[model samples]
Target: MAYKELIGSFDEVRNYIREFFIYGIKKRSDFSDKSGRTYDNRRRQIESWLDGYMSFQQSASGKAQIISVDSREVVHNPLYKAFKTKNFSDYDILLHFCILDMLAGGKELAFRNIAGELQEYGFSGEENVINERTIRLKLQEYEKLGILKVRTEGKKKQYYSLSADAVDLVSWQDAIEFFSETEPMGVVGSFLLDRKELAGCQSNFWYKHHYMLHAIDSEIVETILEGIAEKKYLELVTSGKKHSEEKIKLYPIKLYVSTQNGREYVLGHVSGASGLDFIRVDRIKKVKTGIRCGEYQKFENEYQASKSYLWGVSSGNAKDITHIEMTVRAAEGEEFIVRRLEREKRNGHVYKITDQQYKYVVDTYDAMELMPWIRTFMGRIEKLESSNPQLKKKFDQDMEQLYSMYFGEAQNDIS
Candidate 1:
């Protein structure tokens, strides 16, 4: 099958990776949800980004095609490359250069002047004719991106590049290099390093588990960030098992990264909704600019308050707080167990009822999120209870099932 060459959005790239590489061995015909052309387009796009790690095999007599990946041979995940971002049209690249070139070292100009300059100096690739409307739209976009500064005289709006007089790079070089390699928003540091012509020079920072996908990760982040910066509502399009697409208008407050899992989340208030919501960045298929949504400081402050007691992102209801208690035996050489409980308990309280006994208590919005942590104590947990009795009952059932699986067999042996 001939591969389609068009590059789609990050969501397309992400889903294709999940389908063909992670939970792969899927038949080409199985992708009925997408057009044959679209499926091929997505497959080709994935090949462009992850060519080294991807391969396809055929069924008996070559009746079907199945895609797969073998990570054992790959040294690094190529998914993080900037190219995996939404494919840019030729016009986008052309305008970026033409507009910046015309505005750079020249007086502020409108779209007509820029379009005329492009018409005279000529555009590269595809269409050569100038479209003033497209130019105006791109200029407005650049103005929003801070790539161009706009000025208004009476009614006319003029734009210019935000000055190329190299930013003061003397003191920021070391910091930029280090940050670019390790931190979120570090690409700015990377660009600074590139500008300084020191990109490949060795640095002290190195991460063994590089989240290369975060390159695409931050692409989504930059949008919510733009909303946060402007204090506006953002249009978020997400896909789910039930809904083909779920559209959300969010007053984006802050981004939350999971410590247990390296997932990025946008914590915000649903437009017109009363409580904070956590939206995973990976699930986001699209983001668009929206009208001003007023101040986020109130929600930001409330979210911060929730953070004090939040164990994880599974806050069921904003007002629903459940108190959980787990009594564990902490005697003799196992004092480290109590110390560990103290260290990992976040805002939970740890009290010693007796020298050999202790109870770990926490009031949380999602008592269920703490179950895996409770299970870590195993045989030491003498009692487990939660103000949410349903949680307690579920835990009892799980533990009883576990006991029967192991101890029930032992009882049979004793009989």
Candidate 2:
């Protein structure tokens, strides 16, 4: 009911940030599901996290505010700050520290002993006494998180903090600092970097094409990854402009990160569907892991076999493969163009047809996805062909329009 920087539900915050701050611009009244006060509070929360990147404008709909960030410029994701602000109760905090303290110095205790020790601290929240049930619950939670390890002694269970050799922060500081700023689960590295031993550690790296938005999508990505690791089917809840909650069931195969835009996707085989398709991480609202997939290996093998034909995420038109060939002329000094083609032509081949002429060929599930990359060689392209006549026609029409726009109808021939 009241405004606070700390959030209770990340899903609710993620939805507001994606819909209003990251994806589109909208007036405050556009949110029909929530009251104006709620909208204002959510907006303020996001603005606080994205302090320098936010901007406001007077639009036809009304005055609107948006988070405008150039992904290439930022060294780290500001959105990670929102995730760090989760609210915790006084009892939860006290119990966490108490447990760690009790289990410190290689001390191990049975459940009853741990509960007795916790009671000795006189811990209470909201006037309720901290009972054995609460202490047991906290221990269970920590055991699942690997913070505590449990062992059975006959019929009784003993719990102790999981200990490991201390990492040499001096030796690994740079790597951890770099990972914290750039990796998908960099937030984990960030937590490590925050330890008091590394208080003065700083990152010496920066990315030319840093994508800051993925931090917001990391939670869902982590869930999908868990399903993938366990070889389980995932029941996903996806939302879009037209569809608020479209449920999908899939055998998740792999997580794909786009090199072009840094967006993340999950390549999975939909239940009862024929082939693997990619689901963009941002579209996912919730991921509920389902039953263990008995045929996970079968689908993974199928994806590996079919992935060669994938130019992009499109699994292309239900098994209809398209072939494309193009000839391009690059003058003697433009060897860089040839190298560029060789570097970017995924699943495609390039060979010199002549001193100045080169031929590029590939088979793909969807040739349409390659159009943008093909257009980059407009002036150098001498000939082009596609097995899908519609695709060729679309490319020809687009080239013709470009020629007409720049050179007039008299010089409408792009070839």
Candidate 3:
């Protein structure tokens, strides 16, 4: 069965237990023999699956350590009994221990680097392997639990380190005894304890940012990301009015988030195009990597300046600079409007107006694209005016219709 199917069955079995207990209480009788046997079997199956899962995790973690041998053992010892008796499932404990071990390795690793190391360690098996995606998720959970500290290294890189005072929790002897008792049962339990003692040394080393695009299948997107990291140029077919059958080469500088959707797009320059261009990955048909991009430094200042005028990811053709404005009211419980507006301004946009009643603004692009944000504050705001006369008229008409439908003296009276 698929992993998801197994997970569904496990949840169903757990639900059955809750239902069975409820029915037993209602009937004022003990569970039937058959029902009791079924519950026991299902519980056993879940435990077995959990054991297998943990063993795989431990094995993968060990392999990762072996590959990154630069890690030194931590000096502070953690209490093994404290961790073992905490009611954490065997899988949870194994995952926790693996993360601790990684953090103890003396170097801060990025999420992708940790995932890649896990993959390399041969923890993934044919039927019940732990995938890198799952490992990344588990790492996040560990961070939330305060076992690790996650901090951003750059825009895309997140580094993980051991939490303060993590080493003082348990002693080396306690860890050894706990491992000895649990090791014979499963791979996860055995491997963790086999090391004799927990590593306690702390060091200051950080991993490089390696962006791994997960959902995109476009080769062009992959080529572009890889090219940017390697400082290389790429040749691709143009999609806009300057469409050409011939492939054009350009140096990739940075990635921008698409305004329409949260999808990523490449912001680069065309070799002979008049100005900087934005190309959608899905629109490009072909891509070829070229030599290192030595000219990227020259465009850094220009890119920084252009960011303020950008509407979403598209800088909107280098020549067309359309100024946009909109009015939005802050909803009753939505005091976050001011903070959000401040954040936008901090990112380099103009904050035209901020007052008690509503917010008005002049931004670099069309306000229609920001309509969703405006709608979120519907009851709070009223349409005022737009820099472009046509856009202002449309917004005024839309707001009037919305007001007629939902606005009333009675609606304001309740609050």
Q: lDDT of each model, Cα atoms only?
A: 0.70, 0.82, 0.51
TM-scores for all candidates? 0.68, 0.89, 0.41
Write down the lDDT that model 2 would get: 0.82
**Tens-digit lDDT track of model 3 for 187-247:** 2332344343433322122323211111222334557778888878898765444433457
Give the clash total for candidate 1.
1
TM-score of 1: 0.68
Write out the backbone clash pairs for model 2: none
lDDT: which is higher, 2 or 3? 2
Residue-level lDDT tens digits of model 2 in 291-347: 999998899899888888988888855458898999999999999989989999989
Rate residue 25 of model 3 by lDDT.
20
Best prediction by lDDT: 2
Report residue 80 deviation for candidate 1 (angstroms): 2.5
Model 2 Cα shift for residue 78 (angstroms)? 0.2
Per-residue C-alpha lDDT of model 1 across residues 1-415, encoded as one tens digit per residue = 6664545555566666655555453556767775888777776666665555555565663333333433343333345443435557778888888777777774677556676788766663466765678878888898876777777766765645554455676556667655654455655665566554665555545455454445455667878898888888999888777538889899988777765545788888998777788898878878977998656678778777787677888654546899888899988888999999999887888999999999988889888888888878888889888888887777777777786897773232211
Pairs that collide, model 1:
80-212
